[model samples]
Target: MTETADAVTTGTERPDFPLDRRRCPLAVPQEYERMREENPLAPVTNRMTGKPVWALTRYRDVRQVLGDPSMSSNARNPSYPAQFHVPEEMLPYIAFPFPAMDPPEHTVRRRMVIPEFTAARINKLRPRMQQIVDTQIDQMLAKGGPLDLMAELALPVPALLFCEMLGVDPVHIGYFRRYAETTTGRDSTQEAVAGAIAEMDEFLDELITEKTKNPGDDLLSRIAARLPDEPTLEHEDLVAIARVLVIAGSDTTANVVSLGTVVLLEHPEQLAELKADPSLWPGAVEELLRFLSILDSATVRVATHDVEVSGGTIRQGEGVLALNGAANWDPERFPEPDRFDIHRNAEGHLAFSYGNHMCPGANLARMQLETVFRTLFERIPELRLAADVDKLSYMFDAHAYGLHELPVTW
Candidate 1:
């Protein structure tokens, strides 16, 4: 029973959503190429929920789905394709993150923090970001190799920087990391996920209070300062915003640092190009982003109204999963999409996604990625994988795609 775009199929009829890429960690799932070629808007069963969703694979269709105003990001919508199960009690905590929000409210809240992540702001913070990366590399050098790059450098650099950005005490970075991992961990129990959220909320509540009383030159303090003028925003709203920043900022950047390193090492020619020409570092970062689309599965939405896409119509309230990884690897957009060429114009890639809901911290992520890759390789020219690439454990089950650990030696 082949499921068409308009037909709602049951049981084994539909292909599973979130096709696994564990076998080829650096590439989008092989199934995506077929879907893009055949049924651009293919129907799939959500592995987590066993519900049908319209999977958008083509580059243009993905952009349209993401940019379309009728597509709602609200996970609370009954028909939305939920990645994991959240207990009813945990719904309040899980549902309201700005990324999962829709409409004018999302616009207002997103606008409030837009100034913090502008290219100028990230550029201003570049020196500090460089120092952070250098500090991590220095520590790694001091301790020596055969160690997990993820633990030593990849995770800490972003975690520490996010702590500084949000005015949270750096001493509590371990808790922040735990919150990120547990919340996104596919195997995490509902109770465990709820507990992590509760802990973060408690800590954020205290931090927000302190920021309100003694404002500093940080995101939380700045948002706190505006609380008086913003009548609709509440104390909890501040905590929610801070929580989003902590998880999104730390986890995604950390993953990129670890995964990007792996990709660069695999392609020494591109690595050499970066080493030879420092100016190419930025473009290399973009290409790495395109090649390693870590947030492939996070861009889930439900159509608010019947919307016509490339292949077929997404009926009102139907779930739509825009596979950013597939879009990035779409041959229609990038010629020779499988080839990891640093010089290729990889701009407009869906790595950070498209439209109003595009990642607000994209510039910050880019700066961190640029700083880390440029510095890490230059400092340790001999750095190579200590363990075989095939033996490495990739985080295929998590909400984001990355590595559990990257073993490297110089």
Candidate 2:
């Protein structure tokens, strides 16, 4: 497809293979545009398995596959060519909480847990989210010097919220945070990530045991309470679900807090407008999610049957990538796709994905981001980036696209 522009037939040969390996693929907009224009679906050697596989880059194509029954979401397929193994410790959540399942199955598992992230449910947590925001800002102010918004604010709010939601003991939150970062890191070695996963597993194993007797009002307890009557899922499945709820909820929202701050600081006029009118916070948060594009990879899927996607024929059993980041910025979908506007029409953005597998944590993440943006702008009207914009660092190879640290101050 597209004449195989720069067709790469060989990659490095190494153990763990292409897992955790990242090659910068989108440094040029034209390159991204070319793929979108001429080749939205094309073949490339599977970075892990060394077999040719399909990559779906356009919005419509990616969405189609996301909703396609012919493609499976089991990320643990040993034959599935992945860029990385999720490590055995994190294996329980390879696609748990219904993220890695197909419908009928995903639908049932997801329905069993939907009440936790419902609009009404998350709204009840907003004040707590706001309080976290307020307290973090107060602490940042008290520090009275250069403040990295990510470390001081963005990263913690979600960690605390997720810990509250999953019934993770606050005293042990420091332990889980390490795993959260490691599991989410694309550049981190497998050994370190495996250790973090082991730590989380051991910690959660003990918590799950304790919750059986002294269940709290958190998600793990609620889901655990349902296991006896639920025929499709077991105790292990439920425990795995709780693990995903904590990890996905924490990492995605934290990135939003961190990257969203960088986006606002880069756009001072919009930042000023936000400070003046806090009412616009929710829309602004959604817009930031669109602009920042944290998730660079698609939720992986395996072609269960031969399917023609975007004029390219993918064989049965071939691997496919649903490139949401490329799709979210599609010119045909978003007018002036590359520009960032706080009020941009984001009806089609895929930052949290779409279809039956759409992120269950979307409402909670938006709430946390909305609250942080509201508080940060309200209290620090003159907030701006502390370093030269060009010099600011980004984790280009990260599983999620985000700033390494957002240094900001009033």
Candidate 3:
């Protein structure tokens, strides 16, 4: 017989907790508060398509779920309904790569990327990251007052940094931008997303071909050189590898820059303190990352078998979301999770996440932000948001997160 209403797991059936939960994190303006109060480990029906999902709101629970081995991220199952409703053009490509893979296959492909992402290796990109940041600052200063920080500082830093790391021409960042924005966040029509993916594939194919003949000192060339040795990585696998590195390399950090700037602006005293003491800039970057941990879902993981999680139970083959933002805000971890203090030792925040699949470009991201922060304060000491704080745009309502635009000026 079919499971009756009384047969639902736990004492009571999960409340629908009907939130818009559309292309954004969840419906309703005060989401963080509601999630914390309504259900620390709240069970809610997937409002996007009326499916079932467990929304882990508390910081401890989110971390436990993310780090848990039982959770699985396989999206190929026919029975598994879509957890997010994204524009057709961007849906196929967003939030895949290592974040969505299970082990063995995941481990195989990720090995090619791990060494390249090591703290030592990424640190080598520091000087180059500084150059890109300095160049953008010069341009922004030339424009005088009233500039869109997103365009002036945020976009260019990562765009140039990623292009350099990939050994591609920055002039063609527009190509990646279309795909990045559509898939990472923002809206894209079906045709637009499809075309973007096709174009991206074509770009990757050509890049791999070019790198094949003339490998450079960059990560792309290194990954390509290593690909032949790894039995699991195929030509398509190479392309997928590059696809995520480029898109994520550009998008995730750009959002950090965009949103982090706003955070600094919101707290001017902290901004002034950071400007006066450059040593505090690194700490400031970490604090901003934790405060505005824009990337909504830390990582998408799935269970290989049924497992009992922190305090809840997730059946095997189930999808789980880890909240980097939530963990950063855990009072147990941070003395005052909500308070933004640059002086605070913010090194432990999982803004970059932890595990074998941690962000490959975290060093590059930190470098870009560091350079931007140093140069920006030197240039525009009075930098502040031009638009009302509430008017700023948020990102990746589906499975991902960040900002759309951060309109700021001196």
User: Can you give the TM-score per candidate against the true fold?
Assistant: 0.96, 0.88, 0.85
Could you give candidate 2's per-residue lDDT for residues 1-410 as a string of tens digits?
Answer: 33331243546211221222123322212345676786677555554345556666688888888778888876655435455535545554443446776777777778778888899999999888888778888999999557787788877878887778887766655666566667766567778766665666666667777887898988888877877877887766766676676677556777777767776776788887878888878778777777666774646678778777787666667677676777777777877877778787686688888777888888888888788788777787777878876666666555665566877767
lDDT of model 1 at position 300? 87
Of 2 and 3, the candidate ranking higher by lDDT:
2
Candidate 1 per-residue lDDT, tens place, 214-330, comes to 889998899888777777778888788888888886799899899999999999998998998989999999999999898898898999898888747788888999999999999
Stretches > 4 Å off in candidate 1: 1-7, 10-12, 88-95
**TM-score of candidate 3 relative to the true fold:** 0.85
* Cα RMSD, each candidate: 1.9, 4.0, 4.4
Global lDDT for candidate 3? 0.66
Highest-TM-score candidate: 1
Backbone clashes in candidate 1 total 0
Candidate 3: stretches off by over 4 Å: 1-29, 47-49, 78-96, 186-192, 396-400
Q: lDDT by residue for model 3 over 226-336, one digit each (tens)? A: 977987677778887888787776677777777677777778887888778888888888887777666645455555665564445666555454556666776677777
lDDT by candidate, in order shown: 0.86, 0.69, 0.66
